[model samples]
Structure formats: structure tokens, C-alpha cells
Target chain A: MTADFLLSRYPYVLIAVLFAIGLYGMTVKRNLMKKIIGMTIFQTSIYLFFIQGATKQGATIPVLDPELGPSAELYINPLPQVIVLTAIVVGVAITGVALSLILVLYRRYGTLDEVELLRRMRESA
Target chain B: MTSRFESIFLFVVARAMVPLIQVFAFYVITHGHYSPGGGFQGGVMLAASIILLRISLGEESYDRFPREAGIVIGGFGALAFALLGFASMAFGGNFLEYALAVPGMGAEELRYWGIFFAEVFIGFLVWGALVAIYDALESGGVE
Candidate 1:
């Protein structure tokens, strides 16, 4: 019974754990890459949220077919899939932009450590 | 990070798909209501196209769109969204209420068009904002 319960709630549990880990890393990590990784994890949890919300029992793709009558087994919400696609693109764009910014930071500061870079920047300022 | 052959293959494939991806993005943006896509998806796709260009061609290639233009694009998106909403009001409806905007057109079609146009603006805004943020980060460290 307990196993079944856990299985049913797995998506929520996963989201919570992923969020916690992402938040922890974002807060505790000093490396820019690590922070970016944390951000990615955080964004990924959102994608999971949308997907989980849109899930249905025995659902298939939202595509239509004349042969398949209106009475299909199920149909997962296409809205969420579409939304997640946007989120994924946003995540990738942010990551790429962040990486390039890091490259520039490294070029200017000669270090990837956020704290050290901040310190040098402050000193220079 | 992988072998040279794999890396080269990936690069070649990505290069080959840039135009295709761009076309797909436009299709998604235009026909979003019919499918599982909209302006936001299309916008991201557009940005992804530019990003792909950046990855494939490097920073030197991005000079095609000046940083100033990106900022303008961002503004244009906001303006476009607002104008869309306001235009509905001008047509004797509440803000963003597309149903009353164009009585001649079907309500669903009007909604679709509104969303599509808004998505265009959003795409431009998102792309420009990203470029600006990157530019800012590069010019000054985020301390």
C-alpha cells in the first residue's frame, strides 16, 4: 500500500526534491557553472510540473485520426506539452547566454569562481 | 566533450537544421492555435535560431543584428502586445478581449490572430532581452 502511494505521488516528490537540490546548489555553490546548473535544475522541475499536471491515465499523443473515434483511451493535455517546449527553449537560451557571459567574465577576471570574481570586481571598482 | 567525429557530425547537423528550425518556428507561431504551439513557442524558436547561429558561427556572426536593434526589438514586443490589447478596446471591448475587436472575423480566428501577433512581439522581446542581458553581463561582472 505504501509503495503504491509513493508511486502515485512520485512526480510531486521528485519535483520537491529537485527544487530543494536546485535551491541548495544555487545558494551554496560559488562557481558560476554550478549556479547555472542549479538554475537548469530549477527550470527542469517546472517542466516536470507542467508535464505531471497534464498527464492522464492511458493517454496518447494529442494528434487526431479519423479512424480513431472520439472515444480514445485518453489524451494527455497538449497545452502542457506546448508550454514545456517553450520552457525548454527558454532554459536553453538562458543557459547559453549565461555561459557566454561566464566566458566574458573569465576573460575579464581570469577566474570562474563567483566570489573571487566579485571580490576582484569590487576591488577594481 | 566527445570524439572529434561526433562533435563534427553534431555541428554539421545543427548547421544544416538552422534554416529548418527557423521555418518550423514560424509555422508554430503562425498556426499555434491549431496545434500545441503559440507565440511563446515560436519566439523561443526564433531566439533558438539566432542562438544556433551564434553557436555555429560564433560572436562575430551575431553582428548581423546590432545590440541596439535587439533592445529595440524588446521594446517593440512590449509595444506590440500593448497595442494589440488596446486596439481591442478601441474596437469597443475590454483590453485583450479579442472577441469584440473584429466583429467581422470569427471570434476564434480573432483570438488566434491576437495571440499570434502577441507572440511575435514576445519573441522579439525575449530575444532582445536575452541579448541585452548577455551584453550587460559581458560588459560588467554580475557582482
Candidate 2:
């Protein structure tokens, strides 16, 4: 990529790198908590990606402005923003569920390491 | 959740801050249609205030906002949201079509109030659900 293009497109690159890091953490991390943290990072990067798609160079919020004439182009696209907003809540809920499941697992097996947890589950089963 | 070290200063500050945070949350919910804040944002703020209290007061936070209350408030909010949709339906509007539901006000006014109420309901639901999740995590699915 050219230097000027890279400079202008840093946000997309940053989001991609974060998404890769999160994916690596989720897949490669041994600790369950670390995995959850990775999942959070992944979720955040996705949200950021969608938000970036909704951006306009000089557009305002979705709210109607009386001063400006009724032009559709005056506002940023709101659909992605709405979707991301809902996704954020759902992501938090998922995190809560995951953490609780982890808590139960730790209580049962006395371990948070994935391999150990798997071994203990097999033993109990 | 309890730790050995506790700061009386944090406790008092948390106590003083909770009400203000809650009031601001309410403002955010109420002005959501016209402002940057909204139901979900307000609800998160409400949850934050509770979390602040929980961490600051530790065990002492129980009587103030017991664990049972969380799920109840959340359920109530969800129920209210559904009920409002149903209420609009009963009044001959399709689900959530507020302009055609209530008769007295102008159509725009009716829609505005409908949206306002919906925001409030959503705020309550989110606040309660988050608090419940926090409580469950803290106590490990116990009471």
C-alpha cells in the first residue's frame, strides 16, 4: 500500500489487526478468562468496523436538523449505528453468560485452564 | 466480592454519587429522541451506579439493592415494553404503531409519547438485567 493510502486508511488497518489479535486470543489462549477477553476484543472490533461503515465525511447525526434543508445526505446512515447499538447490549449479555458458565466450571473443576477443564469434565462424565 | 481493605471515603463518596448518577440516567432516557443519550445508554449508566455501590460498600450494599430486586425490575421493564406494544395493538394499531393507538393527542404527539414510554421501559429492562447478571456472577448463581 502507498504511504498516503495507508495514512488515510489507518482505522481499517487498526480494526483488522485488532480482529486478528482477538481471533488469535480466542483460539490460542489457554486461560478461559483470557479467551473471554479476546472475545470482547473481537466484539469491539466488529462494532468499530460497522461504525466505520456508517461514517460520512461531514455528515451530522441521524437526528433531524431544522436549520438544514431536508436532504437525505445530510445525516450519516443510521442503520449500522442502530445495529451496532443492539449488538453491544447483546455482546454484554453474552459476556455475562460466558463468565457465569466459567464461574460454574471453576467451582466444579477447581481450574480455569481449558485443557484441565476438559480433562475434569471427561473424568466427571 | 468482599475484600479485606475497605475505604470509608469511597463508601461515602459512592453514597453521594449514586443519586446523581441515577438522575442523569433518567435525563438521558427522557431526552433520548433528541440527544446523544438513550434508553440503553441510560440503563448502562444506572448499572454502573449500582456497580459502583457494590464495589464501594461491598457486603453493605445488599440491603440497599438486594440481589432479588434486580431480576424483578428487569422482568417488569420487559413486561412493560411488551404490554405497551400490545396496548397499541389493542387500540387498533399494529405492533408499536403509536400514532394510530392513542386518540386524544395529535398523531405526532402520540408517537412521541409512545417512543418516550418505550425508552423508559427499555431503560428499566436493561438496568435490571445487567444488575441481575452482575449479582449472579458475584454470588455464583446463588441467591
Candidate 3:
């Protein structure tokens, strides 16, 4: 594709690549930490998607600037920013809770390797 | 599987990039109302930044994560949001009725303040929670 076409679609391409990498790691990695990394990457890509979607050509800052002439023709939408804020908080809370669970799992299994840990848990349980 | 070189280059780079990304994330969070970025995207970026740091440094280095400050930050964000909501009530409007809360404030100003407070909550939560999760895995691995 030409550069112009590429620029227009680049965000989606980035999002797709991010998703692919994350999914591959999550599915194939034997380490629990690796899997978590994958998940985080996956989640982050979605955030990127939302941010990109909200952006439009030639949009101005939502903040009112005195420098802009009284008849300036543009202002950006602030709604997406508001939505993303809540999503970020929830992601953090979920991360905390997930980490706690992982800790518990570790205490029980004595290992961080996901496959080995799972095997041990099966045996013990 | 990748070699240590790959890990050092890619993974370590990931780690190093996180803090920078996080600074940008904060910028995005605060400036979001005017730009394409917003609270959710910025918050996630913040979490991802720290998560990258953990990945590159390994879990042991997570002691660098600030627990108390994170908790306080998150609490403050939520508190700020609550206060914004309640400000409307105090100003003889329904809760979260930004338009009625302040006669002197423009409608846009009230909206911005309300949104900013909400975004602050997200920022704190993202910072606090991501570190917490990383801690969970790190502690899990070490023991």
C-alpha cells in the first residue's frame, strides 16, 4: 500500500500485531509470568484501539485555548477519554486481584512454571 | 525460544521503555479531554509500562514498586471523583450534574473537572493494581 493508505490504517495494523503476539505468547508460553505478560499486552492493544478510534483528522485539543481565534472551526471529542479512564482503573483492580491469586497458586505449588505447577496441583488435589 | 541476547535486547528494551511510556501515559491522561487520548488508554499504558519493567528486570526487582504511594494515589483518585460528584449536590444540583454545580464555571469547565477527577481515579488504580499483580507473580516465583 502507498504511504498515505498505510498511515490511515496503521493503527489497526499495530493493534492486530499486538493481539497476535499476545495470543501466541499466552497460548504457547509455559511460564505463568509469560502468560501474564501476554495478557497484559493483549489488554493494552485494546486500549490502543479505543484511543485510535477516538482520534480524527484535524481535531483540536478539548481544552479551550485562548490562542485559538474566537471563530476557530474545531474541537475534539472528550467522551472516549472519559470512558478510557474508567477502564484503566478496572484493569488495575483486576491486576491486583489476579496477582494475589497467582501468589496463592505459588504457595500451593512451589513453582512458577505453569505446566509443572498444574501437574503438581493435580496430583495434590 | 529466544536467547538471552534477545531477552536483553527486546525484553530489556521493553522494560526500559515502560517508564517513558508511563510518563507519556500521564500526559495523555491529563490532556485527554483536549486530545484523542483519555483516562482508560492512559491508565492501561501506565500499567503496561510497569509490567514491562518487571518483565525486563525480573520479579526480584519489584521491590522498586511503590506500594504505599500507589495505594494512596488510587484512594485519592477515587476520593477526587467522589468529591466532584458531591460538589454538584452541594451546589444545589443532583449528583454529577456538572452544569448546575457552578454558575461561574462554564459547562465545559464543569465537564472537564468531572472527567479529570474520574481519569485521576483510573490512573491511580492502574498504577496500584498493575504493580500489585506483578508483585503477586514475583512473590509467587521467588518462594
Top of the candidates by DockQ: 2
- What CAPRI grade goes to candidate 3? acceptable
- Please, what is the TM-score per model? 0.70, 0.94, 0.56
Candidate number with the higher DockQ (2 or 3): 2
Instruction: Give the runs in model 3 whose Cα sits over 4 Å from its true position.
Output: A1-8, A67-73, A85-89, B1-73, B76-80, B90-92, B98-143
RMSD of 2: 1.9
The superposed Cα distance between candidate 2 and the true structure at residue A13, in angstroms, equals 1.4
Which candidate, 1 or 3, would have the higher DockQ against the true structure? 3
lDDT of 1 by residue, A8-120 (tens): 89989999999999998788999988999999999888899888898788877786645675564666677888778767866876786778778778878899887799899
Q: Poorest 10 consecutive residues of model 3 chain B by lDDT?
A: B1-10
Kindly provide the TM-score obtained by chain B of candidate 1 when compared with the true chain B.
Answer: 0.73
Instruction: List per-prediction Cα lDDT, in the order shown.
Output: 0.74, 0.90, 0.70
Question: How far does residue B87 in candidate 1 sit from its true spot (Å)?
Answer: 0.7
Report the lDDT tens digits of candidate 3 across residue range B1-143: 11123354766577668778978999988987766666667766876776666556664434766544555655666677677778778878787776554668888888778778777776666566555555545444444
Give model 2's TM-score for chain A to 2 decimal places.
0.93
| Candidate whose lDDT is highest | 2
Residue range A38-81, candidate 2, lDDT tens digits: 99999999999999999898899988899996788899999999
Scanning candidate 1 chain A in windows of ten residues, the lowest lDDT window is: A64-73
Q: What is the Cα-based lDDT of residue A43 in candidate 3?
A: 81
